[model samples]
Target: MVDTLQLILPGFLLPYLDRFMQFGQELFGGAWQDILTVVWTVIKVMLIIAPLLLGVAYTTFAERKVIGWMQVRIGPNRVGPWGLIQPLADGLKLLLKEVTIPSGADKFVFLIAPVFAFTPAVLAWAVIPFSDFLVLANVNASLLFIMAVTSISVYGIILAGWSSNSKYAFLGSMRSAAQMISYEVAMGLSLVVVLMISNSLNVVDIVQAQGQGRFADMGLNFLSWNWLPLLPMFVVYLVSIFAECGRAPFDLPEGESEIVGYHVEYAGMSFAVFQLAEYSAMILGTALISLLFLGGWSSPFGFLPDSAFWLFFKMFALLVVFFWARATFPRYRYDQVMRLGWKVFIPVCLVWLLIVGCWMMSPWNIWK
Candidate 1:
């Protein structure tokens, strides 16, 4: 599909806007024909980034509103009608604010830290399969790629804290590093169970694996998904992701009472950048949950079109659960969070992995 578009685009547009198209093509790539491919890549990237940015903006607004309703109060009604434009107002305010660097801070590292954090979250989307042949890049080892990229964001936190030259920020970053490392183990192990069941590392193949099994043939498609067979691992993955992204109850890195946490020294857009990274990771995690556990873009009924709507619907549902946890749960003690990740979740994931292995080898293997 993408190749077809790439070939068709230049043939149709090059005649009308020859000079401008040639400039873009030559600037982005080596040859004129390469222009269409470059343009197509850019369009796919924009398609992913634009919706992600909008989702992040509205996620903030939705969090405030949902939490407010939970607490029996109206939220963000002053900025625009029913606070529809609250996120826009907040974004503009941040953009207009002055970015400040402390006297002793490492200027270059401090400046680049936010970009380091933000880049990985967005880049990981390249391999995600929204629907059949709809991804920007369909790598064979996509799950591995996502794990590797997501892990790099930890450096941004450490850099932000160290470059700021502040003890409180350093302590917060240390906690974040510890938290991420502990949870990441459990998270990866949980996914190992998924890979074993689906028998594929390619995300599109994994989704397709869930589409036509016995339960799906019986018109109980939802029951046929990996979430049912790997229920324990599914739960572990969900909790570990919460800790991995530093969401509420596990948000030790940004604890409000702990001297305002890691990015406390950051001001204006720099601080906002950290926030953007965090929220982007949240949304990415939501998408992974949908694809890996809830059956990516799969319709419950056979009659529905195989489109991206189902994927986004599942992602949105998971996002609501994320905000719900934030509103309902109190912050865990740093030690308790670490204990949950290392001692509890890790052991559970390991045991479940063994159980799943045995189940897969047995004559009762449902996935077979």
Candidate 2:
């Protein structure tokens, strides 16, 4: 029986054993190098996440200021210099607020859902290529990996809704799930044109492809961006992401007027987690846009090496657009939102994908 078991296991286990042994040897062979790599990774993650957390805090301040300006009112001038400390004040308030769990909620899941939502929001930024060599992880499948991670974040919303045992939260979660799923398809298809032209899944590779001069080595201009060739796809992606992020005109999930939305019952820091996740996701989306279509970190005029400045500049530009849309547009009607996603954005993206595919294969090679 022992011999038979060994013979049977050999077929199934040998490959895994070999892989494990190889991994073990690699780890042991360069222990110091591995330690340095891990330390560097930790530092990089902290650097990225720290600024993001600060950005989230300041984004709230920015939003209030922008919305206040839009409404012709002075915004947040009370706390600290020019109200710069308002986010801190708000953070303190939320921290001091009472955290109340509902009488019959699932305590464990309810407590953990916010963490789940926030984790993916932060993790998705890891693959974003800030510059040629500044990316945290230069995965071959970065585009798909980002999509997968962003898609997984919806589960956090769903879980939060279900665990809350509140009708409004459940409805909000349902709306969010449906909206995210619908927009994700359009967003993915829109990006397909980018990948088709770049012919690479690596974000850095995509940016470099755009950096190549289009005409007689006249150094690539901004017009050579995917945004120009794939204008329709670009529009679709922008709108689709607005929906995916549950931002204004697409914030059906969190309709404060009619429904309190997903975090309806959440309080204190638990509620803060949802807000943090939302802003983080917004930053992630903007970063992806910068990397995918805006020549990521590359100077549009080609006078400068691709640097952090360009990455942050492009990302901040997109972030401004996000806020401008929120301040300018009204929440979309739920049915209209769904129809736009299904009937308009998805179909347009699909047709554009076909156009891009055909363009890639054409003898003329316009994109090339």
Candidate 3:
């Protein structure tokens, strides 16, 4: 169906497609005459994301199931197909529920916050580089673009917490803002090592760079992934991402146990928006890790074809790690979380950046 549409569609549906196909065919051996080929390509991407979105939806269900299994109890089995429809039912319920605006809240900003939060979460996927030649927007500074867009998402949480005019929500917002800013710094620094090694901010470049040289030549196999070379930075970045996403152990922003947290006053669809943003951000975090550390969409062994399979595999591994961290670790205290960010993770990332710098300059040339 997608192929048929692309073949018959007007030349100017998306001008960029024509240019990209021309560039690909001329430079990369892709077909040139049917530049609209990207239409079908885009359809494939959407097909991938459709399942991913559904997976993200049911991830909540799986989290409950797993947590339930850990606690020796049944989870959501009441909905259709052993609660397979629970996420859908949950969506319907949120849609049907009433959206109430607090009397004392700033109605406009309160409503706008979720939109701000949700937009960037989805938009970041535009440059994720799911596979070789398979991304929505293949920008030069894709990493920088992602970081900038994600940073903007913090404003949404801040607005949501502040506009609601609730003390707890305000506190949650403050925590969220501080957490995101601090972690973002560490996350950016960690990527410096990746950029330094790859010599490019384009994700595809980073992955391709890792493929050069043999094990004896580089002293390791494909396991010589950036994760091994920059292990400390990888750990710091992972921890920072948890804080950035406001996930468990670092979920102080929305610490339901202690405070109602941000979005405390949001109800129904408004609340659902916040949930969607959080899940989307989680998927984005995993995708970034896959791109940077796990060699984004590249096979682990180097012999397998570079395809979406590697992308999904790496992403799934990260997602499992996320759940494991959530299940195994206890939440950090507010002050402890702040201290860890400032005193620990940030400093480590900075030090590693310096180490990478020194390594780059030395005659050793570990990266080379």
Candidate 4:
């Protein structure tokens, strides 16, 4: 991760980033380095966060528009040109709206639940590799960090449901928690094969590991990525992520036509926060898919330049898949969801893990 203020900005623009450091040293004496370190860290964090917020906002817009096109209907055309400003308009409305607390709700937990949900969505990005250059923390155990952080968001749903004191909300949350946990088992196992193959826990290392072999040298690098070698696990991971996000056919949590969602009692910006968490999770999930399964920031064809553009392109493509799945599939029954996770997805992942393990040890090991 580029940690310092000087490191994050282009060198040409701030050829004298060190001058600020020098000036700080002069002004604050021995404590100047510490002060500048804090300032630089804050700036770096903001650079990641500000764009993420905008991306999350626009993701919602893209979802609506894409789904609309799939269903042959126009979406979000009222705010700004072609509804480009719809997300901002929605945010402003939510900001000005009142946050209402239910009669028996626990005020503290109720108010904090949204934060619990939102924090993990943003925190996971700290270790995400955007391209060859951009990343925040660059933790060696980034894959584990992501799993640990993302797993916390479910608690927010549970808390929201319990705090609301509504039977429908509570039931919805329980179902969601069960569904999310079940799918996570499959998701984790699929990634086990990835780590086993890469022999590293760092997500970037996993991507770099893909950027090798004969296909890469032949300018057919897409053939060298993990997805081709680990096809079954790739499919498992994709489906597992869909369920993890509570999206599409897996979106029984938000089965508003039937069971009320966990955030049923939330209103105004409080409600908006939950929405933010959901979309952010979608973006995060798509990003991880791009990095882990597809090559992160690398061109599919070796002839093309590797850049952040490919990462964004892959992320956008995955988002289209999300919308496509939503448009194409009807909601799975709660029982069916459980069955798919436990009986289907889990077994598939487990069997693939064994196959991958054996394949890795064989003389014919492609990864070697």
Candidate 5:
């Protein structure tokens, strides 16, 4: 069993099963440097993945706890002290449960759909700037890369519905596809405003752009951020992010009382994966909103030191607003969602883009 486990395990786990073996190889027989380099890369990957996983877990806890407070009730105090361990308990429960597929379901696609849905949310984090120097990939076209990667997840939703062999699931997937596509246009257009102001597709550059101007010089960094000059686009982007993440006020895809959801046929861990994807996407959205409009790791006042702490503080503030919105607003009706995206947001973004373009050519262009 031990031998079998070692053979089947991933390379990272293999080191744990027999650490000395990896280093005892002839290729690196006595070279400590080579062995440490390989191990360091693994550590770097974990440095990113670990916090993200924890963030997703706690995000679930925060949602329930915050909503509980808003509704005048206590939430999830059963599993551990103050429900601090609730996410872990939920994970164990999901892991222990059996996942079932409908007899008529396409087993292969049905099994893969959750993975397809989940991967992009994780992948997009590769380009996110946690601080001035802390990012996995500092690509020049990070914005474009994020836009492309995120757009692929809709296919997973489409597959989920198609493979389920259930009309309700199919309907849910169709709604999801349409909803995502509509809001994505608005999302993209709002981002265009950021790019125009920053004059770069790099996320780090976007944050850097917000750090310029007189307000920054006087130590009131918040006033210099893109949010002030581009308030309309910021508003449109925030609303579009809510829709993109399938949160309340835009959660038409998984209208639980109506279509049940695209993953309605999913059970146990399969369903859990969908939830993970959703929450991760929410965090991703918050991260993007922080980087683009809220100034990434730049402190509200320049008194704070440059560190990942400020980045996460800003990220947390935005995340709290996400929960607050869920508590405050009722979900929009499907027709209303479509109308707001197409009629209102897109047009507003387009007009704003033209306005920004003209301003860039005018004598008052601050970006100059």
Candidate 6:
């Protein structure tokens, strides 16, 4: 969205800013432009982060309402019009609450652990393309950056578990760590196949690459997207995202019926922060799935103009599936989860990666 203030503000503001820039340069004899650039960069980042925070908040509302409908029950309808403002109310409650540290707990790490988890969810957005020009950091190695940054969140889980000074919390963290690591291997391999086909780490280039081929030429662009050609890897990535985000069936880390999660000792907003991190990561996972497989911001049909609406719509569709799966499936046994990740997903991804690589090298190559 364009900044409304740019149009509303006085016409003389630009010249005034220029005069202030010159005055600062004369006084400090240094890079006033760089300082302005930094300030502007911070503003752009805030634009990204502010919406993301709202998205994360509403995701919980969506999940609850979706699951409630599936289970034949009314969800949070008392807070606002059809419970639209429920997330906002919840945020207010969390903010007004207190942070509690358990006795004998490592206070510093206990406090900092949520930051480790939360920062990564926010960091991944830096490279996520909402539209052609609507990204904070459109770097060359954006895909690599996503993989690397997302991997760090598990450490936060482990630290939260350990620093809480509770055995159950530690056990939960261990489960989360192992689960995330195992799934990362399969997910990474699947993305590698995409990299082979697209031949670029830049997220924009990957999406643009999907906007071609016979189907896109025919104006059935959805058919041209990677989800069709990379069906198996697409499945792998989807299932891996569920496990990675610790959603149901794969949510062994926090078997709420049996064991508390890594943040068991946390209370009030401190606990809410961990939850914020989790749902933020869930949003990130959905965004990644939409981008890597569903063609990012591309329109479903060719005649429609590509926009952020398509990307957000696709993300919402995938998120409904995330909630549907959570409602439909039961939690897996921890051992079963491990077996699937290692014995099934890993080998499958590896084999599929090999097959895709070989196919690309064959005379039948269509991606070229």
Deviation in angstroms for 235 in model 6?
Answer: 0.7
> Where is the poorest 10-residue window by lDDT in model 4?
1-10
Query: Over the stretch 57-121, how does candidate 5's per-residue lDDT look in tens digits?
Result: 99999999988998999988998799999999999999999999997999999989988888889
Report the error of model 1 at residue 97, Å: 1.6
Worst 10 residues of 1 by lDDT: 1-10
Models 1 onward score TM values of 0.92, 0.88, 0.86, 0.94, 0.90, 0.93
Note each model's CA RMSD in angstroms: 3.1, 10.3, 6.4, 2.4, 6.3, 2.4
* Predicted candidate 6 versus true structure: per-residue lDDT over 1-368, tens digit per residue: 12444566688786775577678889767676577678778988998899889999999999999999999998899998999999989988988988889889999999999899899989988889888788888999999999999999998999999999999899889888898999999999999999989999999999989998999999999999999989989999999999988888787756777866787788888888888988999999999998989999999999999998999999999999999998999888888989988999888888888888889999988799
Q: Candidate 5 lDDT (Cα, whole model)?
A: 0.88
Candidate 3: which stretches are off by over 4 Å?
1-49, 216-221
Global fold similarity of model 3 (TM-score): 0.86
Better of 2 and 3 by lDDT: 2
lDDT at position 155, candidate 3: 91
**How many residue pairs clash in all the candidates, one count each?**
0, 0, 0, 0, 0, 0
What is the lDDT, from 0 to 100, of the residue 55 in candidate 3? 75
lDDT, residue 119, candidate 1: 93
User: Could you give the candidate ranking by lDDT, starting with the highest?
Assistant: 4, 6, 5, 1, 2, 3
Per-residue accuracy of model 4 over 175-229 as CA lDDT, tens digit each: 8888889999999999999999999999889989899888998999899999998
lDDT of 6 at 242: 91
Compared with the true structure, the alpha-carbon lDDT of candidate 2 equals 0.83
Q: Give the candidate order by descending TM-score.
A: 4, 6, 1, 5, 2, 3
Question: Which ranges of candidate 1 are over 4 A from the true structure?
Answer: 1-30, 258-260
lDDT of each: 0.88, 0.83, 0.82, 0.90, 0.88, 0.89
1 versus 2: better lDDT goes to? 1
Q: Which candidate is the best by TM-score?
A: 4
- Candidate 2 regions exceeding 4 Å error are 1-30
Q: Please state the error at residue 366 of candidate 1 in Å.
A: 1.7
lDDT of 2 at 96: 96
